[model samples]
Target chain A: MSEWWTYRPSDFLLFVPRTYYRLLEHYGAGAWPWQVAALAAGLAVLVALVRGRPGALRLALALLGAGWIAVAWLFLWGRLASIAWSADYAAPAFVAQGALMIVLAALPLRAVDVSKPRRLGASALVASALAYPLLAPAMGRPWAAAEVLLLFPDPTAIATLGLLALLPAGRRAALMIAPLGWCAFQGMTLWTMGAPEAGVLLGAATVALLLPLGRTVRRRRDRAARDRPPASPGA
Target chain B: MPTTLDRRTVAAGFLAGGAAAALPRVARAQAPAPLAKTIPSTEEKIPAVGLGTWITFNVGDDADLRKDCVAVMAAFFEAGGRMIDSSPMYGSAQAVVGAGLEALGSPKPLFAAEKVWTSSDGPAQIEATRKLWGVPRFDLLQVHNLLSWEAHLDTLFAMKDAGKLRYVGVTTSEGRRHGELEKIMAAKPLDFVQLTYNPVDREAEQRLLPLARERGIAVIVNRPFQQGDLTARLEGQPLPALAEPLGATSWAQLILKFIVSHPAVTSAIPATSRVDHVRENLAAAAGPLPDEPTRTKIAAEIVKL
Candidate 1:
């Protein structure tokens, strides 16, 4: 193995930014109207997530699982691996994430209280996945380069994080491990390429991470409020 | 007493020798004769500027991009470049290069150089690489970045001994592992050694270059523009007045001219995706090279930048 320190981040950026965008364009061309299907799926998952019933939650989870599997096979393995060797290694993780989500969907799980904060965070993620295609036009790339939900990893990973965020704190953190890691990897890759999309991914990751922390802190405050003695009225 | 050769046999032998000598010369005369440096071990010459398929040729199965890569390769060969270096570590680059060669009708002058990066089954990897490039055998095979160097070198040397391989070498980039590279160069009978060397990344000059000369191992300079960082940095800057004397119009050509001008450097591989850039890079191998003093000034000017 090479001495690790000898490598800089840019050394790993094998393809240029234009090459990367072209890859997206290529994938988008091959997988058309599927973007429409993915967006519809994202909306269905959002409604199910907002409904906060175990059955609806399971449907949402199943949709996310199917999305992950599709991205793992079609995008990561079939497309990204063509240009980046490391995509082969990351593809398996996406498969595992999909498998785990599918398994979780089958399990008899309770829907966590869909509090206002949880709903907002979860909605943002699904919305982000659906809105991600806008980045193509925003970045001056043609619609052919749009990163669609379930058609690309970034949106899929981000959307998965948003879905998992709907769970109770303990289980939510546990389920987020893979998609969070993927976000970091993809974010670093885009950052190294000097692509502006890094901001979107990294920002989503930050919100995903802090969503749990914010809930935990709020829970602690509620617990303290219940445990403490009542204060003197108007004192 | 020695047996006399038959008249028919002598005539056939003469004809074979004449055809072998005449073909390459005829081809060379069609293009500008880029400066060539001889391999110390074999006395065979290769053009001083070679094409590097790092990120440039990793276009995968995109038909348009593959066609573009072929155009770049066509331009490179048209400019008299022969040696094209690539590694399996560069994703899909070997396959893309194969596509380019096939599209170009497999140019006769291709000096196919590839690196074996796997730790086990070196021969298996080499065979797979051969099928990818559609070549009978590689002109040179290198142990990439010194990974499993001991085992790979033994395999390469064995292949050379068996006449299945023409040359054996090892590569390291970004000036990493020079101490170990020097050790390998001193101990093994290497025909070529590829390492990162440019005006700015001159760490190779202190020992590796001199050691290559002493050991009679031909040096192939990689990252001749620090993988385009040097050129990008020096892009808007003025080309040193010395560049005109050396016939370098662009900074990329000037940097290439500087890299290849070193007495120890046999060839400098500059990777580029653009066909025009490949032509510009190959042009550096032609015309007058910068003198020692001019090279120093060029380096100093770059350092200042």
Candidate 2:
């Protein structure tokens, strides 16, 4: 009776990696011309952010919420659940996340202000949104194999992190939690399945999380120092 | 064409025939019965070869794939197979088995086997699984991978005592939890213990097999094909001259036979979605098992490959 830890990594794998990638290819095929659709949506979100209109972030959150719900219904619950049993539980969790986004959109906990645009952060998000679909094709897979932002998961998660990265220090840190968690999750999943892009995803997640977290910690420490009693002169 | 058929083609034909035979009731009765081994705990015998439903039968909500699995079950039973092993952890495997059996009219010979997975939810899971299988009870109920075996064992014992389960057991696979498994086998009263063992992966032979013999627990070998590694290695290789004496026509049969041939083993449940593979697996039970000397020779030759 060896312990569970004695089991090899390959032993936990229920299905081969090929079966998993086949699901991706199938999803790409099912949601064709998704490139145009994702671009249109991304552009709408971009315009709203750029115009800095009243409640622009609100609209963006609503749009993101709709996208998350769509993914939960169309992909997680609909497609993946057909192939993998874990999706039974995971689908509901995704639904909850989408619903949370909707709740956040309806009532403002964090200020919906992107008035002062951070060009670097905004560009990172837009680039991720625009370029994600090309990744699979560039890797030599068919066009039907590309992962789109709204239709596929990896790009969606990556692009979410990029967008959240632009939210300044205070609110961005809170929002980064989900995307960072998702990156860790999706990264491990792809890595276990031997996908080539897993390393890039994990690395991106680390940067996205660490940069914000490091800034937050420095800010908190500085605040504590300032709030403290005047330092003892020579003591 | 001088009545041509190579060994591979012949083997394929034999496998396909196993599937096709399921369509007619008459052909099934005429088929020869597979060899069986008795469960030492209860003296009840089951076919030496059985069906496994791990990744193979978890075709969640895929109608066409589910149909394909149904066809595989048809092939399995048509080939004289009986015991079928599954778990709740394997997604919709138990449900798929229920669906497949319903499609086939529920053969009386089916030795339904399943596992209780949770520490507290053992009874609940068992009840849910029974409803999923559309059956009243299971032939064998095991603690899945010995996950909190002690806590689950209490429920299993009560169930067996209450007549909800015929046999109470525990299982592990891919050589996982062998040391703890050894402790459970020695301390906990069990009727069955499942593990992974194949010609290429013989880690179980050292302690688990010997311990099973001493404790009088029946063994069921899983991953008998190493999840297709063995098949990939021997896909086009011709049947060795040594195989002729044992009446083995395919690599799948040869490997499965090696597993079930062990004196302590009661069955080997190899999962396969293909009807051909199911037939190939069941074919192992139809022939003579290798003796200790022959087993050594076979292992030596297989290692060289």
Candidate 3:
């Protein structure tokens, strides 16, 4: 048998890139004037988290879970799967992750407090939400072509990572897991399609992973110190 | 993944599929037969071009869209196509095919070919498919993408033995799973193998085509238009002079001819949703196949586009 390799990246593609992006275009158009409402929801989460009130993080987690579930059902299954069968498989994964987020939010874990870095992350996330509606016009795309939070992957990942970053170290790990994994997945998908946001997505995932890792290490060290017997008085 | 070969050898390598026809024929007789070719194993003659339901036939529950699918299937029969290929994984394709067959009175000589896709023993899946296609038996039952090939193969082979299925096969496309597919072809009692092969995507010509020929396995070429990429590229361009004598008029006919005319290829399945597209696609099934030299010429013409 003669040996030759003639595969191209586009050949492996199940859906046309233009067709895939057009779903977001349609979504942006459908959810019109509702962009303000989505932004308001994001602000509510931010305020709730920053206020660090009695029942804030649970409420924030519920809001986050709601976003994930909405995207899983409305965007992935309803919109994307109709065009690409591959998305059908990914839809269930999104639903599972959404459900996981809600469960993690309702649980009572270590008390989470806002730090400066957490504040920065939360502010950046809200800014991303507010900027989403303007993205299409800024990028020279047609009207209602932007990707919004809770309805698209990129902004959802950013928003989730931002919320997870604000939580105290222990709870941060659980919440970040789902969004970080999504970031990693979306990064590769965007890379294959030659989308510009691929690098940004991968970068965000790396940062998200490291943030939780740092907190976990500190928490573990504090426990180690507390558990240790007094450094030998005899010595 | 590059060859250290001259252009002539590369071109000859690609065109070799049109000349490996010494394999046994598995073709069967049909009334009012359209153009047909012999399956390398059973010598049953199937139409040169078949119907593929990858994307076109998977319209889910849309009454208006179902009418168009029915019209497309009707046009397919009118154009002398057989072997409508569907799978459970294709959303509503199997159901759509069933509905189409029903609305059309379950046209005769409809060589039903569907796949079993689950990891579990697929008797239940096969039964479901039978119910969906509304057919007594499938002409061919393949393991889709070779998913759980070992488990499904056991079920498929047993089904074939019991006379529930006419043929047993496996399908893989759009990837370099040839090593595993080739291994299964050698090991299993398979009758057919379907893979992606076209003028531009000619990697199948490398190993799968020759291996199928050597093993006397019928070859079904899927994605003949590279999932409609080649057709889109060839649109608006004048047909190559070579296409006329080979009886290819439009871009779809030209591409389908380049596929079905291959000596080792039992049939090329190019899917379409539009009745006009099916009409154009089935024309190549009856025409003179491109010879080795002509096949090379066609390949060269396509590269320039």
- Among these predictions, the greatest lDDT belongs to 1
lDDT string for model 3 (B1-305, tens) is: 11011323322322342211321121222223346888877888888888898867766545556667777776676556777998877767788889777765666758899999953858888898899899999989999888888888888888888988889999988755788898998887789999988878888888888888889999988888877778878889999888888778887887777887788899888888777787677767676778788888888899889
lDDT of 3 by residue, A87-181 (tens): 77777777777788788778775666545564665656655644655656675677677776766767777777877776666666666766777
Per-candidate clashes come to 0, 10, 9
Q: Relative to the unseen true structure, what is the C-alpha lDDT of residue A5 in candidate 3, on a scale of 0 to 100?
A: 57
Q: Which residue pairs collide in model 3, if any?
A: B25-B43, B26-B42, B26-B43, B26-B44, B27-B43, B27-B44, B27-B45, B28-B44, B28-B45
The C-alpha TM-scores of every prediction are 0.91, 0.79, 0.72
- Give lDDT tens digits, candidate 1, residues A119-176: 7987888888889999999988899889887778899889888888887666566578
Better of 1 and 2 by TM-score: 1
lDDT of 1 by residue, B115-167 (tens): 99964999999999989999988889999999999999999999999988899
Ranking by TM-score: 1, 2, 3
